[model samples]
Target: MALTGSLDAAAQAKAAKAEAYKAPRTAFGQPDLSGYWTNNTMTPMTRRPGVSSLVYTEDEVKKMEAEAEAEVEEGNAPTDPNAGAEAAKPAASSLRPEFAAAGGDVGGYNRGWLDPGHTVMRVRGEPRSSLITTPNGQIPPRKKGAPPPPGFGRGLGSFDSYETRSLGERCIIGFGRNGGPPMFPNGFYNNNYQFIQTPDHFVIEVEMNHDLRIVRLNAKHRTDDVRPYFGDSIGWWEGDTLVVETTHIPQSQGFMGSWKDLKVTERFTRVGPQRVHYAFTIDDPTVWDAPWGGEYEFAPLNGRIFEYACHEGNYALPGILAGARAEEQAAAEAAAAKAAEAAKSKAKDKKAGD
Candidate 1:
């Protein structure tokens, strides 16, 4: 790409500019955004079905949050020591669909280990009904006959090969759009990040998948048609706000399956001592008629960033493939054994007739 350069140049530039950072502000007098922050909340990227507004009333917020808080309490209550295995099964109906997986499946977290924040996402003073600020508070419709979003979920596709699995399953990147051009909450845990800004680059160290995103400052988009994770991000300072433009997003990582020609513009501004107002807009004429995205606030993460170590001690993928093969072989053996039994019975009947 005419724009893409080796990470070496970027790294060297950042190393040189590292000296320019004076706490939160660079020597250039730009607002500093170096800190550990989180965008974890109950709010989802798209609007909920049948919801008509962007902002929720205080009463509505209280009721929804109370429900979430109660669910946690119920989950945290001590279980009967002699409870049956069935008790470990995750009941999707027991919690909101958005949070049903908090319990995961059998042998997963219950409540105390879970970290889907209870509070619905609030932008400024108002509770947000949805993140997308579009007129309908939803992703705009695709052009007629536009292709469906590609890729299959763990259960929906063949798992014969590791490549067949989802990116999250392979531990290639954080699942649920965690390492995003327009980053979004994973709807699960590990939604934390550290922002390290140098005069030449802005780096977001994602706690999930240990994804490291480097944003080149005042750089040009690559014309090489290369699509990599986190895309190609170039940023500039607009007053105290850092405006970033990302393109060439990989199709598998596309937002709602709209990646080609996608350009995501994100603005990160330190709005308060404890919050950073993160806003984004997506534009892809091939997919939608107009651009649409949403805004959310990043609160300070109480803890430090830790290694995700997705592949280490993760036997789920190996187990999935091995288990599938074992099941297939068992089924084939049973079928052959049944055929042999039927042949033997037929031979005995023939002998009697003879």
Candidate 2:
């Protein structure tokens, strides 16, 4: 939130400092953190050991930035925020770990479909490799052989239908990983986000499905209500930072490996005119051994967030099902023709022998 709308720079600075020093409050004196923001970046959810820590060497930052810029310049950008299954670069496999699994040579979109920026964020003007601060810069692995999250219909009976797929495939949530607890950029272009702040809460609308995450500040967790698709979140202010802790995630909204017991802690701090510092910690003891966290700087954009309108426009599901039916019909017809031909050949042979 704007600092009291005072025009004086010195006064604003003083107020901001004071606000950061104290527990943050909302516009209604409750710990104000209501605004539009986004978290679409090349930064991974976890850190990479080669690029561990928020601090990056000048050479590494320059190299990484140059590569990303080259990608854009060469007209090889990403597609929609959650638009996976795209054609990756020729060297996609080599770049896999450095990039996410989304980096592939498989068929998909090009640079014309991407919106990821080239320049990495500077916390204090120094580039960071990942949002996470762990030594390895990676999320800890899930417990060995931990069962897949519930609601997964993988290997289900034939009659189970495709409803067992992820919320994204069903066009329920944002198409990509645009929404957050640890919001990371997808391979697509519209991974952009918008933030709306009100007197009591903050709403983050991801551009994909227009997935909305509402964080209620200075409030208690909703323990009695049904678990939400995006989990339950309660927010508070720690000085200038807006902190939100989320839990009670439904099985439908699994985060990578962890299932129902996952917890995410997020921090949003407006550190610059066009930028906010976004940090998050993920913990699920049943899934991981230790909590891991990361931070990324979000720069404000000029465009307005648009409605995703996925359900209305979706045609992929019907198309896939129809294609399958057509294939089955063709196969059955071919089998029947083959059987008839075989019987006719046998009758002809018998008549000739007689």
Candidate 2, 283-349: lDDT as tens digits:
8888777777766677666677766664677676666666767888999999999999999999999
TM-score of each: 0.82, 0.72
Tell me the spans in candidate 2 whose CA falls farther than 4 Å from its real position.
1-27, 30-32, 48-54, 76-107, 148-162, 309-314, 329-354
- Give RMSD to native, each candidate: 9.4, 8.2
Prediction 1 TM-score vs. true: 0.82
Please tell me which predicted candidate would have the highest TM-score against the true structure.
1
Clashes of 1: 1
lDDT of candidate model 2 versus the reference: 0.65
Residue-wise C-alpha lDDT for candidate 1, range 1-354, written one tens digit per residue: 011112345445543443343335667677988889988888887778887777776788899899888878877877877877677554566566765654646676676776777898866555787777777776778888776665436334576788877888788888887789788887778899999977799999998999999999999999998898989999998877899999989877887778888899999987666778889988988888887788888999998998787578878888889998999999999999999999999999999999
The TM-score of predicted model 2 comes to 0.72
Q: Which candidate is the best by lDDT?
A: 1
